[model samples]
Target: MGLGKTLQTISLLGYLHEFRGITGPHMVVAPKSTLGNWMKEIRRFCPVLRTVKLLGNQDERKHIREDLLVAGKFDVCVTSFEMAIKEKTALRRFSWRYVIIDEAHRIKNENSLLSKTMRLYHANYRLLITGTPLQMTRLLDILEDYLMFRAYQYCHIDGNTGGEERDAKIEAFNQPGSSKFIFLLSTRVGGLGINLATVDIVILYDSDWNPQVDLQAQHRAHRIGQKKEVQVFCFCTEYPIEEKVIERAYKKLPFDALVIQQGRLAEQKTVNKDVLLQMVRFGAEMVFSSKDNTLTD
Candidate 1:
């Protein structure tokens, strides 16, 4: 998803160094393949910030660990997921300014080795970046605290919000020069009864069970009279219940089914309770397999 996540993160580091005087020990854990790109982007965009790459075989890493990898010596440490796990003890020594994870979906399952290893390091702030929608609902749950700490102006509405209050918030958000930067709402609550043509970007942090519900939510920013191109980002998990739900939802659409002669849709039926139950149970096998190997192959 060449969506500039790398550049944006580099810019943030640059801001901290240039403005805040926080020339820091920020650690970035990414895939082995992207480590070079991360280093390149940082040098290309923010050459002033010193960056050290934590990579190589055992002896090379030992050399880096002894000489180049020290606090106050480098602004950022770029490393891969495999290196993080292997050198967890060495990396954990520093209290980082920020621990940023790229391709964060790799840690969607909390039980994963990479996910658990990432938590062993200490950081004032942790940022996870991924194009995929993985555990975005959990991400949204933490935004309130993060936004409050950052003092960012934002408005929110949920099922509990009254119609008048919701409309007022929308009006405030749509007003030009308004300080509001984010509007948080539940899909069912905000899907149909709102128009946010003024909005240019929509982040679907929560995935709806029904595809239509998510589409309607996207239209809030893409309605008539909208000038800018609406960028809709849907955060969904790869496997497990959410993925299965999305798969079932799309398969339910009549247009997705095979249309024979005379526009006759292929024979299909709504997912039954058993099918729904199976979808819910789809990913539980991993948990069970961890306990008893006989439960799954």
Candidate 2:
């Protein structure tokens, strides 16, 4: 999960600033919880870049805009998803170089107002970053995969009984391809679209367990029409979960699916104290054995 997506975004911004010489204004839309982190990362990586945290009432938003546009004081504007939705009208007033969506999975539900607002914005580049992008749950005896997986049921129709004067109502809405704004780069979302082909690189972090999450995340960059071969960097670790995840990802099993099923299984089962104690004891033994080997002359 700590694969430096934010750092990559900062690097991209730096490239746009130095090589392209196109630094007008940039916006980073992320979760409220992470807006501070984004600001911190920006300050640390690109200290020269001016950043203004946009949050508060209408007047506050207006003030921020004035400070940015009129004074030309800030280079990047960081705002939360809620504020983005509230102040979309004001946000759209300025011409932005790049509009980045961190934790872009918040827009998974295209019907939501947040999604609508994000789609309405005009920016040169749109980047989406997240660790988990799909929601899969079981209800009423069916396995349903929403969004990225391409399985969605909009409505149900009733049949006419014996042709007795009856009219059927129709319900419709745009599918996944409705708004073609988001370009996903994640270890949680899976697959890529046929027409979608603009990702440059996908970095994968190493783990102890089967990396179903990382594999699915890589697909977001490697779908059909991708101009270049997706460069995947797996940062392997010594953690047990990381190791197992990497092994499973190599085996080609959907990481999220395994996590979901296993989560459900754990929820439905009861914990075994003796078995857990034995496993803990085994871990302790391994740790002590390693220490003993290191101490010997």
Output the number of the TM-score-best candidate: 1
- 86-176: candidate 1 lDDT, tens digit per residue: 9999999999999999999899898999889998899999999998976435545567668889999998876667889888999998898
Q: What is model 1's C-alpha RMSD?
A: 15.7
lDDT digits (tens) for residues 1-297 of candidate 2: 697789989988888788888675898998898888988998999887788899878787777767654437778889998989887777887778889998877787889998889889888778887767342211111222233356443221112112222112110111333332232222222332222345445444323233445545566556565667666555545543554444444443333444566776576585467745564454344334553222111
lDDT of each: 0.80, 0.60
Residue 90 error, candidate 1, Å? 0.4
The residue ranges of model 2 lying beyond 4 angstroms of the native Cα positions read: 69-72, 135-297
All candidates' TM-scores? Answer: 0.52, 0.47
Local distance difference test, candidate 2: 0.60
Clashes of 2: 17
